[model samples]
Target: MTKSPYFPQPAVASNVAITTEAIDITTLFANAQHATAGGIVLFSGTVRNHHAGMAVAYLEYEAFEPLALKQMQLIVNEACSKWSLSHAHCTHRIGKLAIGDSAIVVITAHAHRSQAYEANQYIMDRVKAEVPIWKNEFFTDGSSAWGNNTPPINSK
Candidate 1:
């Protein structure tokens, strides 16, 4: 079998990555720390026990690594350019994951809390909508389905 490109690796200063191993939030957060940053925000997306009222046993994530990583980097770069951020990073996990496992993480450090918070949210929203990652939801009843993981946007 061919080796997967999503192999685990030590967290570095990369802006984005798709890994098959568990996400190292500590390292990512540490790397996002900046002396000039007055506000730092981290967002971790975890696998929950339930989804859409169904009892989810577990989840499996797969990604088109080439495109996923590229898109992820673009998202992070966009956030950085949009805000006066001192640091920004994002990491996503693939492979089988149990409930409560961290699926993804985004960290942003800015001069103010508002920008940090908004940039972090913006990155997450773009990733969910544009990334080539797919999620499989396995239910307790032995049924499984490719999840519609994208959140609906409000049009007002």
Candidate 2:
């Protein structure tokens, strides 16, 4: 229930966070929604029980706070510029995360559903590709490895 100190003021039109706490989807959605926006797209990435045929036990995420925040802001701003967005908010959870735990969330508000959906996906894809955040996947078989950093083809 603790807010991440890494988060800038939530009142900012563009909000980003990298923290060890659980992501508050409600707060993020509220922040992104605006009276002028007709649509709000929310994407939540959860820690799954499996990955690539391996049984995942948990995941440990870490990030270079300053650079990660800078990159997140850049992604948010880029999406905002491309679409008629009222607000955009992204929050990533660091530290150990168990199955069903939300690892990240992206909320984008726009005048139409198409723009909101596109911008939300774009922000998440760019964050995975360009941000300094990293994650280690731990399997139930006691094996672990770094998570994939491959960017989606459409990210560009």
Candidate 3:
């Protein structure tokens, strides 16, 4: 995908991140606050304890970081353009994650609650559908598999 003209420079691109460390939700919420924003929404996707009737031990995420970041930024930018958003950001964690650990976070700020909520969902849906991230699920039965056996992106 082509770069967005509205994309922030690398130094200021804290809005989208991929990390092996734990995601700092407090900092992300603080950063998403805007003077005119009356509504702020944050969504955290956490690793659950079970999947497909199997007891999950843990999960590992991997991504093509360069493309993942780019796709995440694009999703955020699209949300901003589609709504009256004051701020938007997304961070996804990589490497191993235990049950109940946050895997992804999406935060959005808007002048109204409905816009904030809708934009937040839109960003997440697009991220899950378009980003080049992969998940591996490890079961308590000593078995593991790639999540859904597929990557999110189709490489169109």
TM-scores of all candidate predictions against the true structure: 0.86, 0.86, 0.86
Best by lDDT: 3
Q: After superposition, how far is residue 80 of candidate 1 from its true place, in Å?
A: 0.4
Q: Encode model 1's per-residue lDDT on 1-156: one tens digit a residue.
A: 884433321223448888989998989888887766778999999999987777999999999999999999888877887785778898999999999999999998887899889989999999999999999999999988886744324411
TM-score of predicted structure 2: 0.86
Model 2 alpha-carbon drift over 4 Å, by segment: 1-12, 149-156
List where candidate 1 sits over 4 angstroms from the true fold.
1-14, 149-156
The lowest-lDDT stretch of 10 consecutive residues in candidate 1 is 5-14
lDDT of 3 by residue, 46-121 (tens): 9999876779999999999999999998888877777858788999999999999999999988778998899899
Ranking by lDDT: 3, 1, 2
Which whole-number lDDT from 0 to 100 does residue 103 have in model 3? 100
Taking the candidates one at a time, how many backbone clashes does each contain? 0, 0, 0
lDDT for every model?
0.84, 0.83, 0.85
User: Residue 71 CA error for candidate 1 (Å)?
Assistant: 0.6
List runs of model 3 lying over 4 Å from the truth: 1-14, 150-156
RMSD of each: 10.0, 8.1, 7.1
Measured by C-alpha RMSD in angstroms, how accurate is candidate 2?
Answer: 8.1
